[model samples]
Target: VGCFHQPSIVLADTDTLQSLPKREWNEGFAEIIKHAGIRDAAMFEEIEEVAQGVGDLPALIQRNVAIKARVVEADETETLGIRALLNFGHTLGHAIEAAAGYGGMLHGEAISLGLRAATWLSLQKSGLAAADGARLLRCLAAFELPLKLPADFDSNALLDIAAKDKKFEQGAIRFVLLRALGDAFVSCDITAEDMRAAILHLHEPV
Candidate 1:
């Protein structure tokens, strides 16, 4: 059923989000941020302007759902690789979750840190402008998301977990990297060394 079953209906209710704990609400925002960064520049700008306020929950949910719906419509089975672009911050994000024993950090918190690392890698490897990277960092910071690893975090363990990510294929890990604020692509060229550098950046003081 996981492979072939598709939902016949879906709902996006702003009221539901209002009931979530602050951390979980912020967790959902991480995915919203990722969606904008990977595919929708206009949405990214809107999110930057709005930050995480109580003024427009409906608009925020609509924007987020639209971006995801576009991707899913294009790659319902992930056969053409477009849907995988949704994993923009998940590679390192998942590693952070595992390293924390899955309870130390909320998924979005870890992904927020992963977004920083991925953006750094994008700057280094994908022609992402330094100014653009800084702008994204600032946007994330405005959400009060975690942007740095814990001082005592273990980079080596994170790497090991990242290596086991489900996206690994043919002996290489595939990473979704940004070329611009709203453009991203997956590449199998990311090396262990590249990952180490990004993870090290996480250890830096925010």
Candidate 2:
């Protein structure tokens, strides 16, 4: 199906989610967290409040759907910058997954690490406050998500892989960085050195 053919129906079955193992459930939360991080500070707080449990899966899923639906409705074809905000952690996330040979880490796990790296970058160049990044990290920690690069992870290799991300254009890669929780914007002026420093920062002990 082409971009014009939107899905006829979308469904969220909480019962199915309720049956997943804890690890799998947390994996799904990574995307949910990403959505909240980029679009709604209040939503992020709600998620953080329930970080240890999925007793409200139905409501949580609904909220996640609503956030994404709003973005999609506004930019169905991704021509508008609004839609690209959905890729908040995916550029670095995808590169990490590729460098890990795809199965070394779960997609969400890689993304969780990507989120931290992105936040660090945001603090440096996007005016994201240190306190905001700390708050986000605490939320991620509550879910036991990864916050650092894997052992023996190669920063140079990851950078090489990131350069191949689909978001790259005109010899620069576009990144979604948060100026504050729930406030994200795309910037293509990030230097390669800054990106490398962000990756390295993730490897440092918190």
Candidate 3:
């Protein structure tokens, strides 16, 4: 149930919902791996197996829940942490969503691409290692997520939209970039050079 003024979740045709799995879940994994990372090779292997549909999702979720319970019990703080994760790939993804006129691409599609851009920038500017970045790219590719921005997209327009991102603080746009797998940081000091490079990388294939 939602808040008093909140609307109910919309139920779509089963076939339509099944067909749009990429749109629904790509953004989720984009956020999940941002915080979880491929730090443990075993975990990445599990993810790969799951991607191949040879692994069990319920078992994996149960395992993750057990792991999270150690760090945080059921509480508001835990809820906040979950929301924070939801925002992992949203920084740049929101800009792409706006620039593309909101519905041109799937929500997960935009976030998946945004995750790639942010991860690449993090490797250079935020100390996310190259190998870790490469691992993330591999996973995104495996999921069929777009790793680059469309050639016709204008970087300047994206930046302009980025400036309006709700995560901005005191007029400076803030970004969440991984410093390494399983660790991420928010920074407002990202440079114009990095921004330009990220957009260009998005336009060009890696």
**Pick by lDDT: which candidate is best?**
1
Better of 2 and 3 by TM-score: 2
Query: Which of 2 and 3 is ahead in lDDT?
Result: 2
RMSD of each: 2.1, 1.9, 5.5
Which digits, one per residue and each the tens of the lDDT, describe model 1 over residues 52-145? Answer: 4434657867878877877898899889989999999889998898899847999899999999999999999999999878877887787788
- Predicted candidate 2 versus true structure: per-residue lDDT over 77-156, tens digit per residue: 88989999998888888888888894688888889888888888899888999998898888777888888886699999
Q: Write down the TM-score of every candidate.
A: 0.91, 0.92, 0.73
Sum up the clashes in candidate 2: 0
- By TM-score, the best candidate is 2
lDDT of 3 by residue, 82-110 (tens): 33443557778877887898569877678
lDDT of 1 at 20: 83
Q: Any runs in candidate 3 off by more than 4 Å, and if so which?
A: 1-28, 38-42, 61-85
List pairs with backbone clashes in candidate 3: 149-202
Stretches of candidate 2 exceeding 4 Å from the true structure: 1-9
Better of 1 and 2 by lDDT: 1
TM-score ranking, best first: 2, 1, 3
